[model samples]
Target: MDMTACNVCGKIFGASSGSVCPSCRKLLNIVYDKARAYLRDHPKERVNAVDLAERIGEDERLVEILMLEGRFENRGEDAEESDDDKKRKQLLQDLQKNLASMPQKQHETGTYGSDRHGARREK
Candidate 1:
């Protein structure tokens, strides 16, 4: 019999190919199903491992491990950005470029209020 320690619980058990034991694998499958169903119901919602685990009532480490193992697909990388998203990103890039190209103005001492005299300026 091939015996090994479970990755999640560190319990000695008989295993074959994977690092995780059968019990842990079953639990991970349940978590995976819950996460998948949640994502399916809320297609547009974005969640990290912690958030997903909280929402799905699973361990964050388990979620992260699943993600590392490619059980969960990355929507951001796989899906194309919407037209509005693309436009917004492009506009932001343009604004940043314009701002970067413009010359910076240095602030001078005694520029604003009281203009040399003690009296307050009008505008």
Candidate 2:
């Protein structure tokens, strides 16, 4: 048996894996049940972490942790990507493309220099 600290309450306990202790894990199960029930009742609603926490009367942190644990998922219309999500993905793709081209661009333009004049001096 290994000892670890609970991420939620910061209590030390015996555990072999996961950052949370046994008590926190049990509480998380209860919270997960409530959140699942809420989701079932509001199947079409787009419920973020805060909203779910409010609906279930649980801490937003717990809801967020459950979300991170893959215990909760958006369903139906709520699962669809919003404009902001699309824009975020586009921005990420653009950034990746720019990063991916950096080496090639530097090679083509000979911009990778170690000198103050932007030129490599060979001895």
Candidate 3:
């Protein structure tokens, strides 16, 4: 079997017979066009994977795959952004970085809550 890295994420995977791996087969994630356009249109609203997925109605996993390599960055005057836009981008970046550093899930040792069966849930 053949292998290669994803064009967007750089993660290694099989390359049976295409430029893009099977994982990135969908055009939404496979191509950067939409994401680039998104970045431009929402000049003030810095989009995260979740937002993109909701807006485009694609899988969140696919959005993450397309955006894994990028974090919010202000385009500045080149994108004709207003001061508010730059501020929004910076704020979004800060929020995203904070979120990224957080653990995937809470590590709770005790009972979080109870279900209908009266059994406590633990992580």
Counting only residues 3 or more apart in sequence or on different chains, how many pairs clash (N, Cα, C under 3 Å) in candidate 1? 0
Name the best candidate (by lDDT).
Answer: 2
Candidate 3 — worst ten consecutive residues by lDDT sum?
108-117
Per-residue lDDT of model 1, residues 1-123, tens digit only: 889987788888887847688888999999988887798689888899999999998999888877877776754234334576568778999999878756442333445533655554443
How far out, in Å, is residue 103 in model 3? 55
Q: Best TM-score goes to which candidate?
A: 2
lDDT of 3: 0.62
* Clash count per candidate: 0, 0, 0
Point out where model 3 deviates above 4 Å: 1-23, 26-31, 71-123
What TM-score would each prediction reach against the true structure?
0.52, 0.54, 0.38
Candidate 2 displacement at residue 123 in angstroms? 84
Question: What clash pairs does model 3 have?
Answer: none
lDDT of 3 by residue, 1-123 (tens): 778887645678878735455656656443455555666777677677888777766667666765654423444544645688689889999999889756633554335433423653342
In model 3, the Cα lDDT at residue 11 comes to: 70
Range of the 10 consecutive residues with the lowest summed lDDT in candidate 1: 105-114
What C-alpha root-mean-square deviation, in Å, does candidate 2 show against the real structure? 11.4
Better of 1 and 2 by lDDT: 2
